[model samples]
Target: MAKILIILDERTLYLYQNNQVVRSFPVAIGKASTPTPTGNFSIINKLKNPYNKALGTRWMQFTHRMHGIHGNNQPSSIGKAISNGCVRMYNKDAEFLYDRVSIGTPVEIRQNRRTDSKNKSGYSYYTVKTGDTLYQIAKKFNTTVEKIIAINPNIKNKNTIYPGQQIKIPD
Candidate 1:
């Protein structure tokens, strides 16, 4: 299996195969104060032509919706620090990574130390919209309401989602 390394501190991503670095790309991490989260993760899911909601003043519980490594609908944003939290890549590059990765592949995200989290997995961030429900979002993503609730432990109840809530979708 191919290994992917995301170094948030260096603002670079490396894809490795058979023990050699196959490709590398520059990334725009969260601002200095808002450092990108560091941990071992996996691609739990995939999406295409993803739409991103800009980060605003509000504490978006459902912010980062439309967040995933997907084909860019707006190709112009590549190599820019534009996404609220999601990793934005060029359309062709994202598509290439998507094709090479699977649901259970391991992903290591590090800022200071290396990660050891194994098992292929993925995640997504969704912003709640008007008249939205956990169940509806789950169905749309082919996931379950319980799963969504599990990922976002802060949510007290499935029925309490408000518009502009940023929920994490786990695979």
Candidate 2:
């Protein structure tokens, strides 16, 4: 089965096939003032070349009809948080995803948060608790190993993680 896993904090949308990530694309999520909804959802409807300019080449509404994953005119916004609560992708990427996904495909949106007063990387920090494995932590935060490693340069070796080691967790 196919599924969509969207990590809102990381500004990435991934296409999962048979429980593994097959593809990912940068996305623009909702701004701080207007946060994107996070939860388990499914694609409910799809349209091509919607009448609205804000929804560029494609549109795919999920659980909520008011917001959706869509392309926009501003390609520069793809990796930034500037949308009005919807997920925004570049037109070509949007089309690529739209063509591969269908109505009823599952979508899971996640945004994890943590803070350390000493940190200034603009990313959340997770203090590894006893018995915490990277796999468990990643699953706990609804993130993937690749996403975790992308921000934490310190984690050069996945198997070397130990308890109490504070690591950067991409929000």
Candidate 3:
């Protein structure tokens, strides 16, 4: 059996077959303000090239009829938190996934906090988005950039961050 697992925090979609992950694809998820619901779900409807170009070439409606995993017209948005509660993938990736999965396939969406074996301070995680800056994030969370670095020792260059990159934020 094939199954889908979406880890919102990591912005990844995993394809599983026979209990093993066969493939993984980066995906864009709902923004922080409109986070994707976390729960067990199943693919319900599959549509190819729907009327909306924003949906790209494939649309798989799951537990929530309004929210589906679909192809994205904005390629750069993939792997970022920019969707309106839907999972967005590269057009080709969506097509690839669409060809393999069927309606009613089990889909599980959840958020997992990343923890490095060396450090586990339980700080909040934020997925970097387009035009995001370390200073901006620090200000948004009302913390100092130095504090963020203290919690996330892995961030060597506070000057550089790409969209979809996950970083820890102090609470």
Candidate 4:
């Protein structure tokens, strides 16, 4: 079974299975002015690197939002509070999750209050798809393969991404 976790505190999301981490990526959360609606959400639909311009939403700094993780052909300030409320990921990460998780997968978005985990590493989850690997996912997330393994003790090797597999990403 596929399990999805949306961490509102850290502004990250995770996908897991059998206690194994699958995939993770950086996400843009809602602004302080407008908070992301909390509750369980299902994968209502899927889009491959959707366009914000098509939605009539202007980019923060770029001419357009392209690429994975909500990037557009136009360059813009990405690493900050910009999105209205939707969680924005790299075009690649979003595309990956869009393909792996089905329309009915439960997406739990909640406030995170655990402030004292001994392991303060920023953890994220990535869902595997065809032609995915630890190296590719890590590079796409601006992370490393070793860090990915560190977060996920279950993945013994780097070349192990079967569709639906969840890999943990460590920061």
Give the number of the best model, judged by TM-score.
3
Predicted structure with the largest lDDT when compared to the true one:
3
Which digits, one per residue and each the tens of the lDDT, describe model 4 over residues 74-146? 2242344455555666555555666566656666654453321223557645555445667766775677888
Worst 10 residues of 3 by lDDT: 113-122
Q: After superposition, how far is residue 37 of candidate 2 from its true place, in Å?
A: 0.5
What's the lDDT for residue 92 in model 4?
51
lDDT, candidate 2, at 16? 87
Worst 10 residues of 4 by lDDT: 59-68
For model 3, residues 1-171, the per-residue Cα lDDT tens digits are 999999887899999989899899999998866667555689999999999999999999985548899998899998798888899999999999999899889997756644211135556666676567789778756789899888777787787677777787765
The global Cα lDDT (0 to 1) of model 3 is: 0.82
After aligning candidate 3 to the native by TM-score, how far in Å is the CA of 74 from where it should be?
0.2
Tell me each candidate's TM-score.
Answer: 0.49, 0.65, 0.66, 0.49
Every model's Cα RMSD, please? 11.1, 11.6, 8.3, 15.7
lDDT of 2 by residue, 71-170 (tens): 9999988889898889999999899999888999998876643341324655566656446667877885688888888888888866868765777776
Error of 4 at 124 (Å): 22
**Arrange candidates by lDDT, highest first: which order?**
3, 2, 1, 4
What is each predicted model's overall lDDT from 0 to 1? Answer: 0.57, 0.80, 0.82, 0.54
CA deviation > 4 Å runs, candidate 4: 49-79, 113-171
Give the better candidate number (2 or 4) by TM-score: 2
- Higher-TM-score candidate of 1 and 3: 3
